[model samples]
Target: MHEVSIMQDMLQLAEENLRKSGCTEIRRISLRVGLLSGVVPEALSFAFDVLKSGTSAANATLEIESSPSLFSCGACGTESWYESLRFECPECHGILILQKGGTDLELTQMEVSSTD
Candidate 1:
């Protein structure tokens, strides 16, 4: 699954940051995942669990925050959020345009500890 590769990349980045900061233990890794990002959260979590062994993030906890798909009406200026993709506005029957909120998978935060 692609989640394996994605988790690998995330761990690499986290490890790089941890090393730069002289931290040997990764405590937590937080991610913002959009509904439309085409990523399955369960799969990603399983991937993280499997891939973290023997790495700097072996003991890290993965936190996923889900972002909903947002749409704005071009005619009525109505904004709405949905768990699924939407193309039409419920009010005024106006055409809805996609807004920037979903469709992104981002690593938001990471907590690390230095092993003094």
Candidate 2:
């Protein structure tokens, strides 16, 4: 249930911002979930459904971007995209992979509107 906890935290933060801005509703929430973020999209969606109950984001749509895992090989100094390919550089066949991206779970944007 890490997704539940994560969703709760995301909702709380958004709620705080909305409260401060005097917003009454949220139209959308956008996020970026990397391939290696260890978070399942289906599970996160479900968790959001459960956690959004009675919250400002209750009816908001979750816009998620599935980012692919990328890494740079130190041995060959090449950037490569490794989607569950054993973490090795395809060009150089190096065992060491310096992760460059696709390991982040971030809240990218939010849409808020006032009841006025």
Candidate 3:
């Protein structure tokens, strides 16, 4: 699955950043995943469990915050949050356009132990 590759990249990035900051242990990794990001949380977790071995994040807890897809109606100016694909507005039956907040997968925070 692609989640494995994604998790691998995330771990690599985390290790690189921790190394630069003189951190040797990772305590936590937080991510913001959007509905439109096409990533399954369970699959990502499984990927993390499989890929964390022998890395700085081996013991780290992964925290995922889900973001809902937002769409705005072009005709009615109504905004709505969607958990599934929606092409039209529910209020006025207008064409809906993506506004923001559900198309990105981002690393938000990391907790690490500094090597003194």
TM-scores for all predictions? 0.81, 0.77, 0.81
Q: What are the lDDT figures for the candidates, one per model?
A: 0.89, 0.80, 0.88
Ranking by lDDT: 1, 3, 2
Residue pairs with clashing backbones, model 1:
none
**lDDT per residue as tens, model 2, 37-108:** 888878888988888889888888898887766677778878767544356667788865646667888888
Ten-residue region with minimum lDDT total, candidate 2: 80-89
Q: Which 10 successive residues of model 3 have the least lDDT summed? A: 80-89
Pairs in clash, predicted candidate 2: none
Q: Which residue ranges in model 2 land beyond 4 Å of their true spot? A: 73-77, 81-98
Angstrom error of the Cα, residue 1, model 1: value is 0.5
Q: Please write out the lDDT profile of model 1 over residues 20-106, one tens digit for every residue.
A: 988789999998889778899999999999999999889899999888877899999999987667888899888999887788888
* Per-candidate alpha-carbon RMSD to the true structure: 2.5, 2.7, 2.5
Better of 2 and 3 by TM-score: 3
Which runs of model 3 end up more than 4 angstroms from their true locations?
82-97
